[model samples]
Target chain A: MIALDDTDRAILRELTHDAGQGAGALGRVVGLSQPATWRRIKRLTEAGVIAGKRLDLDLEALGLGVTVFLGVKLALRGRTALGDVERALAAIPEVQTVEHVLGLYDYRLRVVARDIADFERILRRRIMTLPGVGEVEANVLLSEERLGGPIG
Target chain B: MLDDIDRRILRNLQGDPDLASADLATRVGTSSAVAWRRVQRMKDAGVIRATRADINWSALGYSVEVSLRITLEKTAANAFDEVMAERARSPRCWKSRRFWAVSICV
Candidate 1:
């Protein structure tokens, strides 16, 4: 693991907030020259600490107004079943994130849809049809607070 | 109210928010000035919230991550608000979401 100093942490925090800021502006925030800050950012990128910059889209404005967390328990407990289910889940466009977890459920999924009816359709038609899928619990997200990361 | 060009620009930006205005314009088949204006308009309309650094928490020495589902008592009228307020005050609570009846802390 690459060791991070206070300056590196500061740069990360600043970038986490507004990554579109110019390197010179970032430098001003982190108390460094433009080239110096650029080098640090480059290093961080090379080290895979800063994965990439992503646009935070307002999904509500895009008409995707519903977010649901689903806990899926598979009936079969074999590796082949797991692979099949995972592959099938990945193909659905609305399935934002899929996590294989060791807990009450085998998989957890973050799904987005245009509305409640849309979500129900996706869940019944797309999700329930997956191989070895048995029990499913879904929680519809009412509101969310995106606290970026623990970098400050 | 996004046109084809606007959608194209947004798709590219979502993939790589650091794309220069000129490069983005080239990819979207528009003038740099037009691309900048469209992006500005989207930002103003709240379609584009912010460009954020996607940090790799595992690479940053945060190896273990947990998702906890907490259910609060429905008897309390202000239970949800109180719990949400408390979570907001905690720095370690990275992302918190209130579902229909459950609160997910990650």
Candidate 2:
């Protein structure tokens, strides 16, 4: 496991809240100079502690107003088959998040769409045709609140 | 409506939000002040929710990840709230230290 100091954790926390605030701003929050802050961030990124930066765009603003969660049961349960299914699912633009979860299903999918018609099209034309896919269950998500970061 | 400039700015920032305003301006063919203003406007408009750091949890010795499926009893009043409150106290959840994105289905 990679070791993280208090300063490193503080920096991560600050970045988790707002990475858009560049190195200089992040430094001010973490009590480090801009160059020192940049160095630490660079080290973290290079060491694989900080994976990547992501832009959280509003889906409704982008015309995707519906959110659906899908539980997928596979006909063939194998590593290769599952990988192929996941890759195919990921290729769909509307498929926002895919998780190979435990418990009730083999895979869980989060999909966003413009409306019911658009979601139906995706389900029929794309999702159902994927290899090894069977017994797909859909749940319309009413709301989502992100309470924690991936790093935590 | 988002014009070409707004689209360009979003695209550039989405790829590398760490870019300085001047560099972003150069990429999108806009002045530094214009780039800054557009970014700020997008943030205020809620088009850009947040830029976040992605962490590799598995590399942090958290090799095991499990998703729990909890169903509240329909008969009990405030069962959902009670169950969630109980869950909130789980040490494994590390709610104080980490974040979890919770989705509610109605």
Candidate 3:
């Protein structure tokens, strides 16, 4: 693991808040010179600490108003079954994130749709038709609070 | 309120948030000025909230990731608010979402 100093941590915090900030602006925030800050940031990037920059899109504004967390249980348990289910899930656009977990459910999925009817259509036509799919439970997301990363 | 061009710009932005205006415009088949104006308009409309560094916590020694599904009791009126407030105060709780009657923490 890479050992990060206070300045490194501070820079990380600032970057997490706004990745679009130029190296010069970021240097000003963390009390470091532009070149020094740039070097450190470069080092961190090379070490894979800062993965990449991501745009936070507003789903509601994009007409994807409904967000559902689905807990899916597979009827069959095998390596091939898992792969098949995952591959099929990747083809469906509405299935945003698929997490294979060990608990009451085999997989947890984050799904988005225009509305309830659209979600139902995806559930009926897309999700249910996947291989080894069984008992499913869904929880619709009402609101979310982004607390950000562990840089405190 | 997004048209085909706006959607194209957003799609490109999602893949590469740091893409220069001229490059983004070229990718989306639009001029640099049009691309800049659309991005500004989206920002004003809150369509594009923020561009953030996606830090790999695992590389920073945070390897284990757990998802907690919490169910609050109906014994107190302020129980949900209190729990949510407490979660908001914690730095490790990166994201917390409230569903119908369940809270998921990640």
Q: Rate the local accuracy (lDDT) of all candidates.
A: 0.87, 0.78, 0.87
Docking class of 3: medium
lDDT of each residue in B18-103, candidate 3, tens digit only: 88999999999989999999999999999998898988999899997888888888888998999988887878888888886332
Error of 1 at A55 (Å): 1.3
Top-lDDT structure, candidate number: 3
Q: Which regions of candidate 3 deviate over 4 angstroms?
A: B101-106
Which digits, one per residue and each the tens of the lDDT, describe model 1 over residues A31-98?
99999999999999999999888888899998899999999888767744677789899899999889
Residue-level lDDT for B106 in candidate 2: 21
True contacts kept of each: 0.76, 0.48, 0.79
- Give each prediction's DockQ, rounded to 2 decimals: 0.51, 0.35, 0.54
- Model 1: runs farther than 4 Å from truth? B21-33, B76-91, B101-106
Instruction: Please state the error at residue A123 of candidate 1 in Å.
Output: 1.0
Best by DockQ: 3
Worst 10 residues of 3 chain A by lDDT: A75-84
- Model 2 ranges off by over 4 Å: A78-80, A149-152, B3-15, B19-40, B91-106
Residue-wise C-alpha lDDT for candidate 2, range B1-106, written one tens digit per residue: 6689988988897788778899999999989999999889888999999998877667667778776555567799998778667765564553321122342222
User: What TM-score would chain B receive for each of the candidates shown?
Assistant: 0.78, 0.67, 0.84
Model 3 earns a TM-score of 0.91
